[model samples]
Target chain A: MQGTLSVSVWRGGEAGSFQSYEVPRRGNQTVLDVVTYVQRKLDGSLSYRFACRVGMCGSCAMMVNGRPRWTCRTRVSRVASSGKLTIAPLRNLPVIKDLTVDMTDFFDKWAKAGGVFKPTATRAEDFAAIRPTDSKRRHADAGIECIGCGICYAACDVVAWKPGYLGPAALNRAWTLVNDTRDGNGAARLRAVAGDDGCLACHSQQGCQEHCPKHLNPTAAIAGLKRAVAVAALKGRL
Target chain B: MSAEKLQTCLWLVQRISASVLAVAVAVHLITIIAAVQGGLTAAEIIARVGGNGAWAAFYGVFVVAAAVHAPIGVRTVLQEMTPLPNFFVNALSALFGIGLLIMGLDAVSILYRLGGG
Candidate 1:
């Protein structure tokens, strides 16, 4: 508690190396604060990403001590047991720089999962009243708050093994649309999340559920997708 | 059927086979335990299972379920861990599934024949 913390921050690109730094341990200091200190005081060339400094913004996600976490909210005291921390870029995605990863692939997978919703009605139609207490609406609401942090995608083993996998975040988003009664993209979206690289590829290991900072259960959403795809396949829609 | 359709069917088959295996394994283990309590000797156990229509039928179901389930699991693992293409992986996986069925059926037939089927 009184000594300087030994922090190993990954520097450079995908083929980069970890550079160790001695950062002063402070009371209630977050991991992002530690990185900032290393950047301002120790080294000027250090690169990391953070925006809101609060948990709301998903831009601050990084691998903190081997687990994907929002560095702005993650405290050094909570993660650094031995006063040592290893910070790196998110997994299952290409690293852009020191601690920043290329989110293009992540969002591309999101699009591949049919994350975008197609309206069942146009602006000419009146507001389609969907009851808040409806089962499908409730189901949609469960995974609707995803901030696209790419944390779940980083934690997924299937994504690690199978690069073609849509990962959890994309699948969870697809699930929200699958429940959206107003979303005209039903069978098409289900078909998108079907094949070997789709929702069926998930091993249901719940790694995404476990590491999700928002507490969103992608595993459950994926199970819903599986059932939906099966029904669609049976009905000859997929 | 399309590729996605085939993948979904394979997934369904794996799940259904897994359910079948769950029951079959439980029954098989329970029966083995019960029969063993009566004496686990080869002669005694063979006598209990021998000439039993119900036991043969149960084992036949087990063999079929296992044949379907295991190869799918293997195929998934191989697909994830290996860089093999779909065509090669599919052919090999199908052949493996067939091989399992052949081996499983052979065992079942032997058991039935020995049991005086």
Candidate 2:
């Protein structure tokens, strides 16, 4: 590894260009650490957003070498192509500033996809027993770990092609909720996700699956929705 | 039907028609290959299948499947590639489906009527 690393970061909002900076390379340094150095020491005006500095927050994901990745977990040595790095805001989103895209659309779509769980029973009732080994529980377990990192959403070609289309994160969350037997919103949730720009719009390209840090498959969830929607269509319930 | 319901209905139509087309295409190909290798002339082929109710019914099903299947696929492509709204896409899909239905059924009828004994 060289003593100095050359970094090129997107320096402004949607219309801006890349700005280069040189930082000292050190052992165990992450991409976030490099950005911190340039911002704290070299240029205070350079803007970015992060909170936990760990992988749990899912707020530090950005484009690294033209691929969306969680920069908090991404080590500099692993992704520094040609001894250089390029960092930018996630694609297919409205860039608010350097390395930060507005998340309103992402969260709004999640709501539109029925991402929230609704309780089927009132608080007066006893706690519902959910067997972990049950098929629905197993199905939900396979897709419930999404951190809303927006990496999968950014990686999705469907989102890029159609602005109105619900991206992968929202669809994945809908799939999990759809599997939740305790959730009382099955009919409504299914309706929400079966729209023209909902789960039915997914092209099954698996870009979301390939880029997901949680290893969850939104494509599979979408396939489930496709089957469910078809059944609903046949029954005249859709 | 509501727009959302129509979209879902089209999705079902596309999938079901594709399954039918799979069988139709395979049977059609195998029959063409067998008849050609057996030195069946156009007149001979027509004499065998022409005016046959069973042949007419089979081809009728093929025409229906293709008519429904082709339009939905094109609609999806057009929707993804262009900025056209859902209304325009639906309109295009309906037109394409109607056009395919008319042309395909016409061809099926002509083949069944040929060399009528």
Per-prediction count of colliding residue pairs? 0, 0
Best candidate according to DockQ: 1
Cα deviation at A55, candidate 1, in Å, is: 2.0
**Candidates' lDDT values, in order?**
0.91, 0.88
* TM-score for the A-chain in each candidate structure: 0.97, 0.97
10 residues in a row with least lDDT, candidate 2 chain A: A229-238
Predicted complexes: DockQ each: 0.86, 0.70
Interface RMSD of each: 0.6, 1.2
Q: Tell me the tens digit of each residue's lDDT in model 2 across A111-230.
A: 998888999899899998999999988888999888889999999988998888988899888888888989998888888989679888888999999989888898998998888877
Candidate with best lDDT: 1
Candidate 1 lDDT, tens digit per residue, A31-134?
99999999999998988888899888799999999999989999999999899999999998898889988999899999999999899798999998999999
Off by over 4 Å in 1: B37-39
lDDT of 2 by residue, B1-117 (tens): 866788898887888899999999998889888767557687777876788888888889999999989988889888889888878987998899999999988877998878462
Candidate 2 deviant stretches above 4 angstroms:
B38-52
Write down the TM-score for model 2: 0.93
